[model samples]
Each structure stands twice: as C-alpha cells, then as structure tokens.
Target: MCPHFSTGWGNDAMTSTIVFDPLLPWWLIALLALVTACGIALALVRGLSGWPLRALAGAVILAALTGPVYQQEDRKPLTDIVLLLEDESASQRLAERGETTASAAETLAARIEARDNTELRRITVPDGTDNAGTEAMTALSEALAEEPRGRIAGAILLSDGRIHDMDRAPDMPAPLHLLHTGRSDDWDRRLRIDNAPAFAILGEEVSMTLTITDEGAAPEGVRDVPLDISIDGDEPQRFNVPLGREIELPLSLPHGGRNVLQFTTPYVDGELTDRNNTALVQINGVRDRLSVLLVSGEPHAGGRTWRNLLKSDSSVDLVHFTILRPPEKQDGVPVRELSLIAFPTRELFLEKIDDFDLIIFDRYKRRGILPSIYLENVRNYVEKGGAVLIAAGPDFASADSLYRTPIEPIVPARPTARVIEERYRPKVSELGQRHPVTAGLEQEFDGEWGRWMRQIEVEQTAGDMVMTGKDDRPLLVLDRVGEGRIALLASDHAWLWNRGYEGGGPQLELLRRLAHWMMKEPELEEEALWAEATGQRMRIIRRSLSGDIGDVTITSPSGETFERSLEEVSPGRFETQFGGPEIGLYRLENGDQSAVIGLGPAAPVEFEQTIASAAPLAPMLEQSGGGALALEDGMPRIRDVRPGRPAAGRGWIGLTPRGAFETASVTQTALLPAWAVLLLISALVVGGWLREGRR
Candidate 1:
C-alpha cells in the first residue's frame, strides 16, 4: 500500500499540507453512524458476506464531507547579540590601564562584528558620582535587560576588576568574560584612620588609632616607614612606624573649634599614588571648664551684674571676692568679730594664677589692702598668657587709680584725673566695625544703643579703641600684652543695658564675645585663613581686622596653585566658594596666615588596590564557565560555540549560537476539491460492490 500527504499552495508558489474541517453538524454524523451500525448488525445477524466491504464504502462517503486545509509561513532569521562592556572609572585611568582598555575594546569589537549572524553592543562604564567608585555590574545588568534574552550569545568586559556593585549582578543567560588591565607589579601605600573622635576637650589629650598598610606587589623586607604629623599648618614632626601595623597617637587640641591635624607618610618609589599616603582629621575642641576670677574693689550697684553674668553660664567656674572695707578705714571692732575673711590675695595672684582663664576687675582702685608686690604679679600674669578685663568707674580717674600701681606698665590707657558725667550714647568705632568683638554688634541694635552715664577721660595711648563716648574719647580699648589680652571698658554703666534703660542693647552678647575673644578662641582670631569642605566643594573664609585683605592663594594636593580674591561678606569677614577638581589635601595661604584641609576620604576606595587582578569577578566567571585573560599577555581570539558548553579557553573566548528567527507572512489552502472527493467516493463504492457481487 502507498500513503500520500498534502502540501500547502500559496499565491507565490505551489505547496502541500494535511488538515480537516467537518462539513456536517455533530447530530448528522451521529445519525449516519447509527444507520451504518444497524446495517452492519443486520448483515452480522444473517451471516452475510462482504460485511466489512460495505462498512468501508460508508466510511469513504463520510470522509469526503469533512474539509481539511494546509498552512505555510515565511520566516526571517535574526542575528545573535554580543555585549562589550568597557570600564573608564578613576581606577581604570591609572597607569597604562586606560590605553590597555581602549586597545582591547577596539580589537574585541572589530572581531565580534566580523563574525556571521552577530550584532555588537558597545557600552562604556564611567566613574560614579559622589565617590561611589566603579559600577560595572550595574551597566551590565541594564544591557542584559534591554536585549532579547534568546538572542544574547555572550558578554565581554574590559576593566581593572574593581567593581563595587557585584551584588547587583544579573542572572546571565550566556557566559560573562573579563579582560583584565594594568600591570601585576603595581603597588601602593595608604594611610588609614581607623578611629578618630569628631570632638575633643581642649588642652586635653585625645587618642586616635591609625594604620599604614602596603598593598599589591610591595617590596619584600620593608618594615619601618617615616611618617610626618602637623597641626594647624605648623611644622611637621617625623616619626618611624612599622608597615602594616596599627598605631595609637595621643593628640592635644590647641584651642576651641575646628583643629586640623594632618598625617602623612613619605613617598617611596614604585607606588601607584601618594594621594592616599596623607590624611587629615579635623577635631572640634571644646573647653572642659572655664575658670574666671571676678574681683570687686568695693560693693556697688553694678557689681552684682558681673556676678550674675558669670554665674549664668553652666560651663564657667566663678571665683568672686569683694572688699567691703579698705585697710585705711579700719573699724573699732576686734579682728575676731569681723565677719569678712582675708582675700587670700597671695595665693590667687602669685601661686595659682595660671589656673584661671580670665580675670575681671570691676571698679577697682589701688588700695593698701593689696600691696604693690601683688599688683606687679598681676602685670606679670597678663604678659604670660593671662586675660584681664578692667571695668573702670570714677575711681579710675582718681590719684589712686590702678594706673599709679605696679600694673601701670600694662595698662592700655592712662587716666587724666577727669571724669565726664553726662548722658551719651555709646557708639562702635569705624575700626570696631572691623574688629571681631564689635563687628556685628551694631546690627543687633539697629545702629543705635542705650546711653552711658559716665566715662573716664583718658589719653589715646596704645591698643585698639573699639568704642568711644563723650568728645570721642576711647570708651572701650583692647590690647595684647605679650601672650595675653587686655580689655578696658572706661564706663561702669554697661549694667544700664541689663536694666533695660531706653530700649536695652546687646550688652550681654557684647560682653560674652569680648570675654571669649580675650581667651583666644580660634573663631575670633583677627588674622585667619581657613577652608571648609562639603563633598568636593570648599568654602574659603578669611577674617582680618585690616581693611586691605590680599588675595588668597590655594594649593591643591597635586601642587597646583590658584589665586582667588575674597568678597567682603560683612565688615571684617571675607569669603568665597571653590569647587575642588580632585580629592586630597588642600592648603590656603593669605599673607602670613595659612591653613590646611582634606577633601573626600583619606584613602578613596578606587585607590585601595591599584593592581589589576581577576579576584573580584572570579566567582561570576566560574559560575558561568567563563575565563579571565590579562590584556598584557595578548588579545584573545573570539570564537562561536554551542550552548551548555565551555565558552572560554586558555587563549580564546566563545559566543553561543542562538538560532533566533521571525515570521514575515503565512498562507493556507484546502487539501482536496469537491469533485475530486466525489470521484474518490464513487470509486471506493464500485470496488467494494464488485467484490461483494463476485462472492
């Protein structure tokens, strides 16, 4: 017997296929089955001959009623996709890696494009912003998601193997190969600050832990390395430390507020970069406790004001003394009956003088109670880094004023034995508007302040006259004596502001700033240059008492210098913002003052390991049966392979063959015509009847 199958026929060409579509409903087919079954049953019951032949004839008639069709389609084949990812991050730009990556990428792309039925996808990964390091894996994941999964044959990467987002790696359908860059002998030395306190008590030692480590192919037998340390742009101190070890150093803050401490390791030959070899840590210094000595010559209305102000501050430890009676005015009462205790002048003035941070003399006059010897000690104390504030009154103009005592040498002004008693408003001098202590005081009172009742007449001697009253005489004077500071307020009526006489002024604030400035707070320094950094931007601030502030010179970590002129933001403050191009230490200089600050991390993550290696991406390559090849050896050959097979070898990379395609058009046709089916049914009936007749 011979069997036949039909092919489809379309408008363009002739073809063959086999399909079926029933012409009659299911009830008619069921009725035909019942009639055929009855006839076959009758023939079987009568033992009739040719029973199967009759049934065959009936089946042929039923088949011609049902219709069948054949379908055909036209398909267009799609090319396979190959991804080439190139890394151009900061780490990849080091040494010869940039050249290596460029060359390798060009060659690999050319080779992939030369192959048959292959499409090349080129993606370049750049350095992430805000110090995010390398993000090669993120780029790869995005490329994979955009392309057809079935058509993606393989992926190739050219990088330094410093990927930061390995956890975001995709579940790749094809092999992922890496071509490493950079030399194997590359090495680097870095300084790491393991632990540093953001704040420390001033004049007290704070501990910091640091480690110096050598990475990559470092020289053998290397142990001790010279390290240099500096504070606030001062001279650097050199010390020898063992390599690859943690060391603890105790640091002392010089004054309050941001104190910059710089640590550096000497550069050696064959290192990647010296950027990580230096580090800067800024510590905010806070005073543990401020001790102030308040001495009142005789009790007066304004004496209690000084006590209240000093006692209000939680950080101040106040020691106050009042002389109720002068030695010349001794009473008849016995010494034992006296309620007052000895002032202990010798102990406070000579022995423990250095313990106090500030001393205030309110309405004081040279009396016999404190001898001239003890008064000389006060003058010596001021010259040796002590602070003294003299609140003068009518007594300052008298013959026994402190100007006649042993402390006369350090007095900023001399009284002329004339006291002006009149209502006059205090005013900030033009120079005072530039001085830090009095710079912004007028702004607080809208350029107007309360009145003072009296001011001592004095000569314009030595020191800066920050305030004036009554014929423009110096009302407030500030001067530096040796290493100490002295401020003399000629009037004792500042207490009037505390009493809110005629719309009170910023007397409290003024007095507070004056006290702090006298104690040498860094924020109140007359001549200063400093820079504050946020991210990669820095704000350079210059504070000066002089009206003429020269241009500030900035030095970058790589020894590049830039000069920028400061704009006067206020009376004495000049400031400007700079966007630093790179991360590392920066130096600022204005006249004789200088400052140093660090930007970004001490050791950026990109420079932590400079040498190129396959360790970071080794797991991904192993899981996908891919291999890593060093570009320094040579560019590998590209080849095509079958899926589920090894995609890489010693000197070659492979891409899988994806047989992807698309259908452009389709067509359908009936398998047989109506006349042909009728003819076939007639032939079958005649043949079956002939055989039955012969029997």
Candidate 2:
C-alpha cells in the first residue's frame, strides 16, 4: 500500500526570507520613472522615444510579478476524528429491533465519547412522512459535509439496517460500520392490495388483486385468515384468506353510486399488529341506462312536462301509463260501456317492480278504480331500492291526492288542499344553492325566470326543500326511505315556466335533476359524507338537511381521535377539512353517523416495519463493504477496523486506548506571518532581478 504523502516541498526545511520594505523594489520603480522621464523628454524634443516607453512598461511588469507570498513553517499536525452517525428510522422501530438498537447505541456512544483523542457527533432521525423509511444515508452525507475529512476516524450506524436513500450516501472518510437493530426472530405480517382501480362503472363487475406477506419475525407456517370486504354499507363478505400469496376477488356493484369498498383482515394471535388490517377505497359506478315509468292520471299540459323530461334522455326507457278515462266513466258508450281499458297496476307494480328504475305519479288521485292493495304494493316497491317521483297539481291537495292514500306513509310532505294560483317565479332555497340537484343550474338564467301560475301548499316533513314557490314554501320535496328515494314537484305549472309565462326558468334542469336524484345516484344524495386527500392533508365535506351539525369525530389510522364541528354553509350541506396526523384508513363518526375514508396506505410509521435486516438493503449496503450486524448479537464492540478489512468479526473490536484525548484542547495555527511573507517575496524578487541584470 502507498503511504500517505503531503503535497508540499519534500525534505527541505528553511528557505531564504526578505523583509517587507517599499525601497526593496524601489530601484525598479525608479528605473521605470527615469525611463518615462527620458521618453517624455525625447517626445518633447521630437526625437525617437519608443525605446524608453518599452523600457518603462517592462519595469512595471517586473515589479508586479515579484509580489510577496509567505513560506511554510514548522507546525503541529491535527489528527481529526470524524464521527459518522447513522440514525434508525421507523423501519428501525421494529418490534424487538428498537431494543437492540438502544443497547448498541449506548455502547458505541460510550466507547466513542470516552475516547481521549476523539470526538463523537450524532445524527438523529425522527419519523418520516409517507412510506419513505429513515433517510440515514442522506443525514450521514450532510453531516460528513459539515465535518473535516482529515479528522474522520470512521462511521458508526445504529439502525434496523433498512435505509431507503442509498444513492445519496457519501463515500466515507473512514470505514463504515452498520450495527443493525433486530433479532433473528424479527418478523411481521402486512396486508397489501397489489392492484386497485380509481373508478368502477355501475352494475359492472370489477376485479382487485391482493397479496399478504409474512415479513421478518413471521413464523414459518401456513395459516388461514379471515378477509372481509364490503361495498357501501351493505353486509360484508368474508373469505378464508391464505397467507404469503396473491388472490383475486371479483366485486359487482348493485347500483350507480359511490361504493366505499373496505378490505379487512381479522387480527391473528401471533401477528405483529392489526394496524394494517383495514383499507378503504372509493369507486364511482356509471349509469348508462335508465328505466322510467311515467304514470299520467289525465292528459293535460302537465302530461307534456313528463313526456318532454323523459324524452330528453336518450338512455331512458319511458313506459307511460296514462289513465285516459276511468273504467266507470261512460258517456252514451256502446257495448263495451267503457272509454278505456283497465289499468295494468298489478303487472306494473308487482310482477316487474324491479324492471323500472324510477316511477312517476303525475297528478294521480285516490280514484276508486285502483284498489288500496295495489297502492300498498307500490309502497313496498319504493322501500325495495326503487325510485318514485310525484308531480302534484290541484288534484294533489284535494281529497283524492296520493297523499291521502297508503302512499302517504312514504310521502315526504303533507299536501294542503288550498291551491295557490298566484303566478310567481320559483327560486332555489339556500340549501339548494350547494345541493347537487340545483347547484349550478341557477347560473344558467341571468334574468328573472318565468313564473308558475299555480302551486300546492305543502308542509315538508322528512324531505329536503330544495325549491321554493310563493314565500319560500316548499315547491319541491325530496326524501329517502329505506334504500330508495322520492322527489315531489308540487306545481304542475312548472311547465308554465318553460312556456315563458313570466320569463321561463330552469324548468328542464330542475326536472332533470329531480329525475336523476330519484335514481339513487351518489352525487345527487341530499345527505352525503365524502373526503378528498393529497398526501396527509384532507378536506372533509358533509351534506345533510340538519341546519347545525355536531362535532365530527375523526378516527385516525392509529386509532386516535380528532373532533371538530362542521360549518353549515347551506340549508342542507355542512363541510370541513383537516391536515391529518398520519396516513391510513380514517373514519369520521358524528354520533351514529359514521363514514370510513383512506388517507395513505396503512399505519405510516410501520408501513415497512423498520428492522435492521440486510434483505431489503443488501444491494446498496454491500457496495460500501458495510456488513449488517444484528444488535441482538450483542453489539460486536466498536473497533477501528481498517478500510477494506472485515468490519465485523467474532469478538468485539472495541475502540483501542479508550478516551485517549479526553482533555486535549483543539487549536488552529497559522502557517506563515505577514512579515515572513513580505520578507520571502522580497528575496525572490531581488534574486530574479540580479540574475536578469547579469544576463
């Protein structure tokens, strides 16, 4: 091996020195002054003076080239001992790994701190966000930069042996030692979803891939685990999941809505923990086809409203059931004695109740023609995930209104027989402004909207009053009973608004939303709870008919509680967002109102289970010739293991002559004095001038 050498004069001790004096180089200055004087004299006499000018210029250059520089002197050398410390991150926080690290750290710190001629510095690491493990390599690089390379003795790392930023690790000034924190028994079981999509079309089947792995400390055995999956708030399906393998599960959504699919694995007896057992995913289902059943009591101007609304939708399958005339109505009729055939209430309401997506009752009254049993069947249809809409005219407020029938039990409002005939423009209530149904529709009409000639005086009960007519009375009512939805448009004259009676309103949009909400689309829900997240920051929003909401109790991924009251912005919607602590599945619960949302992956702190093992970091750590040693092996006492030599071995390589420089003071000495520099420079200048003078 080549011995270290200093980049300076070898074997030479003393060099000549010249004292600082302006007169030492004054001869050159005087020569230049005399040359210039002669040049000026010759120029004034109009003779050849170029020779004197050149001489003067040469002298000036000579003086500047001979400036002073101090020479090296005898001095004491400093043997700097660089302390390269590697920190243990969350990965190092493995179950028994941390304890191993603590013992190794104390031993190494004591050994280095007790050294007499050395100093010890530490690079500590806190927790990292996301899944990035401890940046021990990066921290070491920065610490190395701030310290002197010549003083670096070696580097000591106390970690779970897991480092993510190996590319940023700096070339060590000395040997690097990795005292990993972990035991041979260190192991973990993690739940991982190998694949998932952002959105799934409604009524369509989607597949998700999942995997379960047994990490370090995991027992070497095959076991069956319970994995539960749920869509929306429905009953969960459980499976006897196998460990250390990949599985594919097929999921089918029943409706067009936002399904929050949760995948959970029951905690095992010997498992590290259950922090990673649950995961939440939000998927939006697409609605491409709509089946609408339009029932018309009598053919009127409002009959066109129902037809126009349903016809506007190309995907809608409209089955219109218009009772043109009751079976009893006969005006001089012939043999049949009936103007119209009997209505198919049985087949429509019972036989194929699920075929139609939404059923509309337009100005239908309690006409004795349809039996109460048929109406009761309709009520059951509404409860079984079916949509219903009611467009009431004056007949709705009368004794024959459906509100007076068995259907009233599911109706959101109680209709008053009093008919409001005054023409006035209908407007969205405060709640409607933020409501998905009427939110952006108001901006469509800049001027005064046309008016509706007649309105029903209805008292809203369990529904949302999105639109108001005649002094903010509920002109529209929407409610949800069981798993289905209902929308009530009190005024049949809503079509009159489209006729430009006063100015023409957003009649088309209002009716369109009314129909869509009845279909049970998520974005159209009157009461909703959802969240949007970027990194650890989250913005939570809640939509409800309640004017004021209580504290929104938030359950963090680590099972921590964060509560805050939501601000009521509209008549129905309340909202708030928070910068959460860590990443994972977060739950929002207000009283009995509870919702689950995902922030990041699992418990952010132990996402990777920081344990000082060489498995994950072998490739990079081996490049530095640094071998990972388990702290459970009883820290192989820190030794000055020469570079390129085996860093760790059987017996502890304890630092020699411990605390050798404990009381040693550190002081920096100047290599040369100002006077010595000036003197040395003068001698060189005089010597060069004398040699040139001889030439």
Best lDDT among the predictions, by candidate number: 1
User: Could you give candidate 2's per-residue lDDT for residues 509-575 as a string of tens digits?
Assistant: 7777777777766667766776777777787778775666688888886789988878876556677
Screening candidate 1 with a backbone cut-off below 3 angstroms (N, C-alpha, C), the clashing residue pairs are 6-16, 6-17, 7-15, 7-16, 7-17, 8-15, 8-16, 8-17, 19-68, 21-67
State the local distance difference test value for candidate 1: 0.84
Q: Estimate each model's TM-score.
A: 0.83, 0.69
lDDT of 1 by residue, 1-695 (tens): 11324333342332234556668986797788789889888987876676776776677666655556665556567899999999999888877888989989999888889998899999999987778888998999999889999999999999988888898888888889999996778898888886798999988899998899998889999899999998876889999999899899988888788888888998888888787788878889989888999989878889999999889999999999677666566667553333466567789988998899999999998766668888888898999999999999999999889789988888899999999999999888998988888888878776457788999998867889989998788999999999999999999999998888888788888998899898888788777778888988999999988878889999887899999999999888999998888887788989998888878865677876667788889999988778898888899998888888888999998888787867666576766677877777677667766867887
TM-score of model 2 (CA atoms): 0.69
Query: Against the unseen true structure, what C-alpha lDDT does each candidate score?
Result: 0.84, 0.69
Worst window of 10 by summed lDDT in candidate 1: 1-10
Runs in model 1 deviating more than 4 A are 1-74, 142-150, 333-342, 445-448, 622-625, 659-695
Candidate 1: TM-score?
A: 0.83
